[model samples]
Target: MGSIFGTDGIRGIYGDDKVNEDMAFRLGKAFVQFLKRSSDHPEVIVGRDTRISGERLQKEMARGIIVGGGRAFISPIITTPGLSYLVHANRADGGVMITASHNPPQYNGFKFFNSGGEKLSRSEETVLENLLSDTDPDRGLKIREEAVYLKEATESYVRFLLSTIPKDMDFRGIFIILDCANGATSSVASELFSRLNIVHGLINCAGDGENINRGCGALYPDSLKEYVLHLKAVAGFSFDGDGDRVVAVDERGDVIDGDQILIIASRLLKERGILKNNLVVSTIMSNMGLMDALRDMGLRHIECDVGDRNVYETMKAHGAVLGGEESGHIIFREHHVTGDGLLTSLQILFAMKYFNLPLSKMSKWMVPFPRVMLNVGVKKRPEINSVAAIRKVIEDAKKDLLNKGRVLVRYSGTEPVCRVMVEGKDRKRIDAWANKIADVIRLNLN
Candidate 1:
């Protein structure tokens, strides 16, 4: 009954309250009930990442949908964005993706998308929550039908992604590397690059379910960086568990985060005269340098809250085609409604080819200010401003930066942690300051 959905969706350790089979089943019935308000026998697309629990959750949800008089089309082992695309492409009423994204293997959840392939707005989520509170998992336990399985789901997504790139662009002789995070993309990334004639190596592409995001992926780009340098490849990319985020590595082995990727892609779009309004949308979590870089290029920058959904909504409101978070949730609105890690990589590749430059050269436009982030585990989340000790430390850290740096304190929407970020010219100072803020949060919240 209580709102279980976090910033993204209902996420927690699998088998825990709110993420178990019963919740997934009830949520599915609720989703069906909500969709039936507009259409009878609403069709829903269901997909999941490589988590071991994904299959179980998908089956339970499908069972609920069947009993609720809804049609469920289940895709085999697909990424979150892939599922979103299918929802839009298939013209389904809506979709659900079983994933916890970058969270560890034990964590799993669902991301729901509307028919337009956008994440559900807060109001829509509320409708589902209310419906969930009313629905009983066992009340309509008779399954009338089995969910339909789409065997070509991954193939459809791959084909659509390939189509987004230019037809004539040559990728021959481009040696690249990919770290699939042993997650959703593991099954499709290699096939994608191979079709494009890209000479590539894949690491962490084998998922045993438990190995997804175990130590590789966008969350740990160092492994990809090392592989990129060791192979002397032109570039590399690391994707998160759900394949909605990416962290790139260049030939020089320098990690290119979402901010740099945004700068690079924005410049390319501007050069191609396709950048609408000359505007880029980024979250407040973006680096100060990214803002400066955008200004230097005479592009407009709008900062939103810390979520890709927030960035996308702001982008849509302003007619902006480019937006993302610094953590690698870049949304190329012109191509898709949601962020796709594989799509982003291709866009970056397109940028490189369009400019006739290597990944390192294409990414050198921005010099990120030194930023340090510390995450403190918390038992509960109160508004940061309402906590005097935490608020005072955050304000003092900002003041100490002398208008040159900034401090941001926020709780992780997906996890039980408080994130303290401090950025400035002085790395050591910001690092120490971030730790101080994190310590205060720990003392007060923990």
Candidate 2:
């Protein structure tokens, strides 16, 4: 129960190795109490993915929510982005998404979103953490038998998904293929795709509870790629387990990543005179090609740390309308408070249709710079945060690159490793420099 929240939220392998029911209940209670002082008194919506433990964990979390004097309207097997949309759209006090997101099937988690339908900020997390630390662990256990809404949550989400899209996109002749990773969005993505009059190929559309995110969804999209090529479809989009991020495979069977998606979307939006400030915000993990492409289009580019939340922060601060991480966590500021993979994919494909260009042609807005990343586990996890030796390696690499290229060193938020990254036009040079930094970190920092 101690400090389970990471830079994102609480995530772990299911059962004893990870978060337990006791912890779930406590988090629920803690979240409820933390939000009680807000304008509304804890009318938090709750939702989970299609993992095997979703139902049981849902029950436990709901109980905790009720105990905290919060009414829990629990949704069964809903996508993460839908939960965010629900939180804000319904005017709920906040939302709790019980998803492990692209983690393995055996993992589960609890994510807290504020009234704005975005993930809680660092200050909010700190409040929750402080409350957890000061409270009695056994105090909130008695309220575990309270009430919750256990049905029909997915219906509202599906209806809203169809309603929120721009009225002009009609892909009547285009074919679409979607791989939902057999997770939460299985039912909704297909229905939405079909209603739009697009010829559709849907795979991994069945979540067996045991197969979520198992090399089929956005993370490993080879199967979708193969299916798209075989069907000769225009393009295919894949969603991760929780369905908040999307990746695509073009008609030529090449996998298109989040950077490419954002590039295409920005260009299209700019042309339509809808892109605010003519700017896009991306994380440091975004390819230099993406930055260059945005720059060439006379669009300003802002970069944040390597997370969707950071991108959102930059967008909010800079008045940008679009932002995302390279992992497909796109924040369409006009549409959502956070990343919505399915929606982002929809936006991209609709733009493609508007332009009537092949995915290959539409996607080639940028020439990707060669880059290499190496992660090294450390004996003392805090060394990545504190060690001077780690700093020297990055600074030296950056100086060496000196306008010709770039290097980035960061600690993994979900693991005890320091990541070393180098980027340049030359792949060999980038890899060599990345290895050099990795060697120094391995020998001296850790």
Output the lDDT of residue 143, model 2.
60
User: For residues 1-446, could you state the per-residue lDDT of candidate 1 as single tens digits?
Assistant: 34788888779999998899988898889999999988898999999999999999999988888778899999999988899999999999999999999999999998898898899998999988888889886944677778999999989999999999989989998999999999999989988999999999999998988989998999998888888889899999999999999999999999999999999999999999999999999999999999999999999999999888898999999999999989999998989998899999999998888889998887779989998888899998888899999888888888899888999888888878888888999988898998888888889997
**Cα lDDT for residue 151, candidate 1:** 91
The local distance difference test score of each candidate is: 0.91, 0.82
**Model 2 misplaced regions, further than 4 Å:** 1-3, 16-18, 139-146, 383-389, 444-446
List model 2 lDDT by residue over 228-345, tens digit each.
9899998999999999899989999998888999998898788889899888999888988898898899999988887777788889999999988778898888878888887887
lDDT of 1 at 424: 96
Kindly give the stretch of ten consecutive residues in candidate 2 with the minimal lDDT sum. 135-144
